[model samples]
Target: MTFRIGSGYDVHALVHDVSRKLILGGVTVPFDKVLRGHSDADVLVHSVCDAILGAAGLGDIGRHFPDSDPLYKDISSLILLKRCANILNEAGYAIENIDTTVFAQAPKLEPYKDEMSHKIASTIEISPESVNVKATTTEGLGFEGRGEGIAAHAVVLIRKISKKSG
Candidate 1:
Protein backbone atom coordinates (compact mmCIF):
# COMPACT_ATOMS: atom_id res chain seq x y z
CA MET A 1 0.00 0.00 0.00
CA THR A 2 1.08 3.57 -0.66
CA PHE A 3 0.62 6.72 1.38
CA ARG A 4 -0.14 10.26 0.33
CA ILE A 5 -0.30 13.55 2.19
CA GLY A 6 -2.41 16.62 1.46
CA SER A 7 -3.07 19.96 3.03
CA GLY A 8 -5.98 22.41 2.88
CA TYR A 9 -6.79 25.89 4.13
CA ASP A 10 -10.06 27.81 4.29
CA VAL A 11 -11.37 31.12 5.59
CA HIS A 12 -14.78 32.72 5.98
CA ALA A 13 -15.89 36.13 7.05
CA LEU A 14 -17.84 36.51 10.24
CA VAL A 15 -21.23 38.21 9.95
CA HIS A 16 -23.46 39.70 12.53
CA ASP A 17 -26.59 37.78 13.31
CA VAL A 18 -27.89 37.31 16.79
CA SER A 19 -29.76 34.17 15.82
CA ARG A 20 -27.31 32.52 13.49
CA LYS A 21 -25.80 29.41 14.96
CA LEU A 22 -22.06 28.77 15.18
CA ILE A 23 -21.51 25.13 14.38
CA LEU A 24 -17.98 23.75 14.54
CA GLY A 25 -16.95 20.15 14.66
CA GLY A 26 -20.66 19.38 14.69
CA VAL A 27 -20.95 21.15 18.01
CA THR A 28 -22.94 24.30 18.48
CA VAL A 29 -20.95 27.25 19.83
CA PRO A 30 -22.37 30.30 21.48
CA PHE A 31 -21.30 33.37 19.62
CA ASP A 32 -22.51 36.80 18.62
CA LYS A 33 -21.97 36.21 14.93
CA VAL A 34 -21.58 33.29 12.54
CA LEU A 35 -19.59 32.75 9.40
CA ARG A 36 -21.03 33.92 6.10
CA GLY A 37 -21.12 31.42 3.27
CA HIS A 38 -23.44 29.53 0.97
CA SER A 39 -23.21 26.53 3.28
CA ASP A 40 -23.35 26.25 7.04
CA ALA A 41 -19.87 27.83 7.05
CA ASP A 42 -17.98 25.37 9.17
CA VAL A 43 -14.46 26.41 8.26
CA LEU A 44 -12.79 23.60 10.19
CA VAL A 45 -14.84 20.89 8.56
CA HIS A 46 -14.42 22.45 5.14
CA SER A 47 -10.64 22.40 5.40
CA VAL A 48 -10.65 18.79 6.52
CA CYS A 49 -12.86 17.85 3.59
CA ASP A 50 -10.54 19.54 1.15
CA ALA A 51 -7.51 17.80 2.63
CA ILE A 52 -9.09 14.40 2.16
CA LEU A 53 -10.04 15.22 -1.41
CA GLY A 54 -6.58 16.46 -2.20
CA ALA A 55 -4.96 13.36 -0.69
CA ALA A 56 -7.17 11.24 -2.94
CA GLY A 57 -6.12 13.29 -5.98
CA LEU A 58 -9.65 14.51 -6.51
CA GLY A 59 -10.57 18.05 -7.42
CA ASP A 60 -11.53 20.61 -4.81
CA ILE A 61 -14.79 20.87 -2.95
CA GLY A 62 -15.91 23.77 -5.11
CA ARG A 63 -15.59 21.63 -8.21
CA HIS A 64 -17.41 18.71 -6.67
CA PHE A 65 -20.11 20.71 -4.90
CA PRO A 66 -20.50 24.18 -6.22
CA ASP A 67 -22.11 26.85 -4.12
CA SER A 68 -24.01 27.98 -7.21
CA ASP A 69 -25.92 24.73 -6.98
CA PRO A 70 -29.20 25.28 -5.20
CA LEU A 71 -29.04 21.79 -3.72
CA TYR A 72 -26.15 22.84 -1.51
CA LYS A 73 -27.75 26.02 -0.27
CA ASP A 74 -27.40 26.30 3.47
CA ILE A 75 -26.16 22.71 3.64
CA SER A 76 -24.21 21.60 6.68
CA SER A 77 -20.51 21.02 6.07
CA LEU A 78 -20.67 17.65 7.79
CA ILE A 79 -22.86 16.42 4.93
CA LEU A 80 -20.24 17.63 2.49
CA LEU A 81 -17.52 15.86 4.47
CA LYS A 82 -19.48 12.61 4.29
CA ARG A 83 -19.73 12.88 0.52
CA CYS A 84 -15.96 13.43 0.31
CA ALA A 85 -15.42 10.31 2.39
CA ASN A 86 -17.49 8.31 -0.06
CA ILE A 87 -15.38 9.59 -2.89
CA LEU A 88 -12.21 8.48 -1.09
CA ASN A 89 -13.70 5.04 -0.46
CA GLU A 90 -14.58 4.69 -4.13
CA ALA A 91 -11.00 5.55 -4.97
CA GLY A 92 -9.69 2.79 -2.68
CA TYR A 93 -8.17 5.15 -0.14
CA ALA A 94 -8.64 5.28 3.59
CA ILE A 95 -7.78 8.06 6.01
CA GLU A 96 -4.74 7.35 8.18
CA ASN A 97 -4.56 10.59 10.12
CA ILE A 98 -5.49 14.28 10.05
CA ASP A 99 -4.14 17.35 11.83
CA THR A 100 -5.94 20.65 11.95
CA THR A 101 -5.36 24.16 13.27
CA VAL A 102 -7.85 26.97 13.66
CA PHE A 103 -7.03 30.66 13.85
CA ALA A 104 -9.15 33.02 15.83
CA GLN A 105 -8.45 35.91 18.19
CA ALA A 106 -11.50 35.82 20.34
CA PRO A 107 -13.57 33.22 22.12
CA LYS A 108 -10.91 30.87 23.41
CA LEU A 109 -11.30 27.48 21.68
CA GLU A 110 -9.16 25.22 23.79
CA PRO A 111 -12.15 23.80 25.64
CA TYR A 112 -13.60 22.44 22.43
CA LYS A 113 -10.51 20.99 20.79
CA ASP A 114 -11.07 17.45 21.93
CA GLU A 115 -14.67 17.38 20.82
CA MET A 116 -13.62 18.86 17.50
CA SER A 117 -11.12 16.08 16.93
CA HIS A 118 -13.69 13.48 17.81
CA LYS A 119 -16.20 14.91 15.38
CA ILE A 120 -13.69 14.97 12.57
CA ALA A 121 -12.56 11.42 13.29
CA SER A 122 -16.12 10.12 13.40
CA THR A 123 -16.91 11.71 10.07
CA ILE A 124 -13.85 10.07 8.46
CA GLU A 125 -14.38 6.77 10.30
CA ILE A 126 -10.92 7.03 11.86
CA SER A 127 -9.98 6.75 15.51
CA PRO A 128 -9.88 9.92 17.59
CA GLU A 129 -6.17 9.36 18.14
CA SER A 130 -5.69 9.67 14.40
CA VAL A 131 -7.06 13.21 14.40
CA ASN A 132 -5.60 16.26 16.09
CA VAL A 133 -7.22 19.67 16.47
CA LYS A 134 -5.53 22.83 17.67
CA ALA A 135 -6.46 26.46 18.06
CA THR A 136 -4.25 29.54 18.00
CA THR A 137 -4.30 33.29 17.81
CA THR A 138 -2.62 35.23 15.01
CA GLU A 139 -1.42 37.77 17.56
CA GLY A 140 -3.43 40.54 15.91
CA LEU A 141 -1.42 40.24 12.74
CA GLY A 142 -4.03 39.26 10.15
CA PHE A 143 -7.69 39.35 9.38
CA GLU A 144 -8.16 36.46 11.73
CA GLY A 145 -6.40 38.37 14.49
CA ARG A 146 -8.60 41.34 13.75
CA GLY A 147 -11.60 39.10 14.27
CA GLU A 148 -12.87 39.68 10.78
CA GLY A 149 -12.92 35.99 9.96
CA ILE A 150 -12.06 32.52 11.10
CA ALA A 151 -9.57 30.31 9.26
CA ALA A 152 -8.64 26.65 9.43
CA HIS A 153 -5.80 24.52 8.12
CA ALA A 154 -5.76 20.73 7.79
CA VAL A 155 -3.17 18.17 6.83
CA VAL A 156 -4.15 14.58 6.15
CA LEU A 157 -2.51 11.30 5.28
CA ILE A 158 -4.24 8.58 3.31
CA ARG A 159 -3.33 4.97 2.67
CA LYS A 160 -4.05 3.22 -0.59
CA ILE A 161 -6.01 0.00 -0.45
CA SER A 162 -4.09 -3.23 -0.72
CA LYS A 163 -4.65 -5.56 -3.70
CA LYS A 164 -6.74 -7.84 -1.53
CA SER A 165 -9.03 -4.99 -0.53
CA GLY A 166 -9.35 -3.90 -4.10
Candidate 2:
Protein backbone atom coordinates (compact mmCIF):
# COMPACT_ATOMS: atom_id res chain seq x y z
CA MET A 1 0.00 0.00 0.00
CA THR A 2 3.00 2.25 0.38
CA PHE A 3 5.31 3.61 -2.29
CA ARG A 4 9.05 3.20 -2.19
CA ILE A 5 11.95 4.47 -4.26
CA GLY A 6 15.39 3.01 -4.86
CA SER A 7 18.39 4.04 -6.89
CA GLY A 8 21.10 1.88 -8.40
CA TYR A 9 24.42 2.67 -10.11
CA ASP A 10 26.87 0.40 -11.86
CA VAL A 11 30.16 0.73 -13.77
CA HIS A 12 32.22 -1.65 -15.86
CA ALA A 13 35.77 -1.31 -17.09
CA LEU A 14 36.28 -1.12 -20.83
CA VAL A 15 38.84 -3.55 -22.06
CA HIS A 16 41.00 -2.36 -24.89
CA ASP A 17 40.81 -4.08 -28.27
CA VAL A 18 37.45 -5.61 -27.38
CA SER A 19 34.10 -5.10 -29.00
CA ARG A 20 31.80 -2.65 -27.25
CA LYS A 21 28.07 -2.92 -27.23
CA LEU A 22 26.02 -0.80 -24.90
CA ILE A 23 22.75 -2.42 -23.95
CA LEU A 24 20.27 0.00 -22.46
CA GLY A 25 16.71 -0.79 -21.60
CA GLY A 26 17.04 -4.18 -23.29
CA VAL A 27 18.12 -2.61 -26.56
CA THR A 28 21.57 -3.27 -27.96
CA VAL A 29 23.63 -0.33 -29.14
CA PRO A 30 26.49 -0.14 -31.60
CA PHE A 31 29.88 0.92 -30.33
CA ASP A 32 33.55 0.19 -30.81
CA LYS A 33 34.10 -1.84 -27.59
CA VAL A 34 31.53 -3.75 -25.59
CA LEU A 35 31.49 -3.87 -21.84
CA ARG A 36 33.52 -6.63 -20.25
CA GLY A 37 31.78 -8.88 -17.75
CA HIS A 38 30.69 -12.40 -16.92
CA SER A 39 27.36 -11.80 -18.57
CA ASP A 40 26.44 -9.65 -21.53
CA ALA A 41 27.79 -6.74 -19.46
CA ASP A 42 24.92 -4.44 -20.25
CA VAL A 43 25.61 -1.63 -17.83
CA LEU A 44 22.21 -0.01 -18.35
CA VAL A 45 20.16 -3.11 -17.70
CA HIS A 46 22.39 -4.03 -14.78
CA SER A 47 21.69 -0.75 -13.07
CA VAL A 48 17.97 -1.00 -13.74
CA CYS A 49 17.84 -4.54 -12.41
CA ASP A 50 19.74 -3.50 -9.31
CA ALA A 51 17.37 -0.62 -8.73
CA ILE A 52 14.31 -2.87 -8.91
CA LEU A 53 15.90 -5.43 -6.63
CA GLY A 54 17.00 -2.77 -4.19
CA ALA A 55 13.53 -1.24 -4.09
CA ALA A 56 11.93 -4.64 -3.52
CA GLY A 57 14.49 -5.54 -0.83
CA LEU A 58 15.71 -8.45 -2.92
CA GLY A 59 19.44 -7.86 -2.68
CA ASP A 60 21.21 -7.00 -5.95
CA ILE A 61 21.82 -8.28 -9.46
CA GLY A 62 25.06 -9.99 -8.51
CA ARG A 63 23.40 -11.89 -5.68
CA HIS A 64 20.67 -13.20 -7.94
CA PHE A 65 22.95 -13.82 -10.91
CA PRO A 66 26.44 -14.74 -9.91
CA ASP A 67 29.26 -14.12 -12.33
CA SER A 68 31.04 -17.20 -11.07
CA ASP A 69 28.28 -19.34 -12.49
CA PRO A 70 29.13 -20.38 -15.99
CA LEU A 71 25.44 -20.49 -16.77
CA TYR A 72 25.41 -16.72 -16.88
CA LYS A 73 28.40 -16.40 -19.20
CA ASP A 74 27.59 -14.01 -22.04
CA ILE A 75 23.93 -14.19 -21.02
CA SER A 76 21.56 -11.54 -22.27
CA SER A 77 20.81 -8.88 -19.67
CA LEU A 78 17.19 -8.90 -20.88
CA ILE A 79 16.88 -12.39 -19.47
CA LEU A 80 18.34 -11.23 -16.20
CA LEU A 81 15.87 -8.37 -16.12
CA LYS A 82 12.96 -10.77 -16.63
CA ARG A 83 14.12 -12.78 -13.65
CA CYS A 84 14.37 -9.62 -11.58
CA ALA A 85 10.78 -8.73 -12.46
CA ASN A 86 9.62 -12.13 -11.28
CA ILE A 87 11.36 -11.54 -7.99
CA LEU A 88 9.62 -8.23 -7.51
CA ASN A 89 6.24 -9.77 -8.35
CA GLU A 90 6.82 -12.60 -5.92
CA ALA A 91 7.45 -10.01 -3.25
CA GLY A 92 4.10 -8.31 -3.94
CA TYR A 93 5.58 -5.19 -5.44
CA ALA A 94 4.12 -3.40 -8.43
CA ILE A 95 6.40 -1.25 -10.52
CA GLU A 96 5.33 2.37 -10.80
CA ASN A 97 8.06 3.77 -13.02
CA ILE A 98 11.76 3.68 -13.77
CA ASP A 99 14.18 6.30 -15.06
CA THR A 100 17.63 5.39 -16.30
CA THR A 101 20.65 7.28 -17.55
CA VAL A 102 23.58 5.96 -19.53
CA PHE A 103 27.04 7.52 -19.56
CA ALA A 104 29.03 7.17 -22.74
CA GLN A 105 31.41 9.22 -24.83
CA ALA A 106 30.86 7.80 -28.26
CA PRO A 107 28.10 6.75 -30.66
CA LYS A 108 25.41 9.20 -29.64
CA LEU A 109 22.36 7.37 -28.28
CA GLU A 110 19.72 9.94 -29.07
CA PRO A 111 18.75 8.03 -32.19
CA TYR A 112 17.86 4.87 -30.25
CA LYS A 113 16.12 6.25 -27.19
CA ASP A 114 12.66 5.33 -28.40
CA GLU A 115 13.54 1.73 -29.13
CA MET A 116 15.31 1.42 -25.81
CA SER A 117 12.31 2.69 -23.88
CA HIS A 118 9.89 0.46 -25.76
CA LYS A 119 12.01 -2.64 -25.31
CA ILE A 120 12.52 -2.19 -21.60
CA ALA A 121 8.89 -1.32 -20.95
CA SER A 122 7.60 -4.31 -22.87
CA THR A 123 10.07 -6.65 -21.21
CA ILE A 124 8.81 -5.62 -17.77
CA GLU A 125 5.16 -5.36 -18.77
CA ILE A 126 5.09 -1.70 -17.81
CA SER A 127 3.72 1.17 -19.85
CA PRO A 128 6.23 2.75 -22.22
CA GLU A 129 5.69 6.02 -20.45
CA SER A 130 6.64 4.40 -17.17
CA VAL A 131 10.18 3.76 -18.33
CA ASN A 132 12.62 6.43 -19.43
CA VAL A 133 16.16 6.07 -20.74
CA LYS A 134 18.59 8.92 -21.23
CA ALA A 135 22.21 9.22 -22.33
CA THR A 136 24.98 11.64 -21.39
CA THR A 137 28.74 12.00 -21.24
CA THR A 138 31.16 13.15 -18.54
CA GLU A 139 32.44 15.95 -20.78
CA GLY A 140 35.79 14.14 -20.88
CA LEU A 141 36.62 13.74 -17.19
CA GLY A 142 37.10 10.31 -15.61
CA PHE A 143 37.07 6.76 -16.88
CA GLU A 144 33.80 7.29 -18.68
CA GLY A 145 35.16 10.57 -19.95
CA ARG A 146 38.15 8.80 -21.38
CA GLY A 147 35.86 6.24 -23.00
CA GLU A 148 37.39 3.49 -20.92
CA GLY A 149 33.97 2.07 -20.09
CA ILE A 150 30.28 2.80 -19.76
CA ALA A 151 28.14 3.32 -16.67
CA ALA A 152 24.46 3.63 -15.89
CA HIS A 153 22.25 4.95 -13.13
CA ALA A 154 18.64 4.07 -12.42
CA VAL A 155 15.89 5.11 -10.05
CA VAL A 156 12.78 3.01 -9.62
CA LEU A 157 9.52 3.50 -7.77
CA ILE A 158 7.41 0.60 -6.59
CA ARG A 159 4.21 0.25 -4.67
CA LYS A 160 3.17 -2.61 -2.49
CA ILE A 161 0.24 -4.60 -3.88
CA SER A 162 -2.84 -3.92 -1.79
CA LYS A 163 -4.70 -6.89 -0.43
CA LYS A 164 -8.10 -5.34 -1.09
CA SER A 165 -9.50 -5.41 -4.60
CA GLY A 166 -10.32 -2.17 -6.40
Number of the predicted model whose lDDT against the real structure is largest: 1
Q: Which stretches of candidate 1 lie over 4 Å from their true place?
A: 162-166
Candidate 2 Cα deviation (angstroms), residue 115: 0.9
lDDT per residue (tens digit) for residues 1-166 in model 2: 6998878899987764355455656677766666788888888889989999999788999999999999999888899988998888888898999999999886688998889888888888999999999999899988999988889999999999954233
Clashing pairs in 1: none
Model 1 lowest lDDT segment of ten: 157-166
Using TM-score as the measure, which candidate wins? 1
Alpha carbon lDDT of each predicted model:
0.87, 0.86
lDDT of 1 by residue, 75-157 (tens): 98988999998888888888999999999986688888899888878877889999999999999989988889999999999
- TM-score of every model versus the real structure: 0.95, 0.92
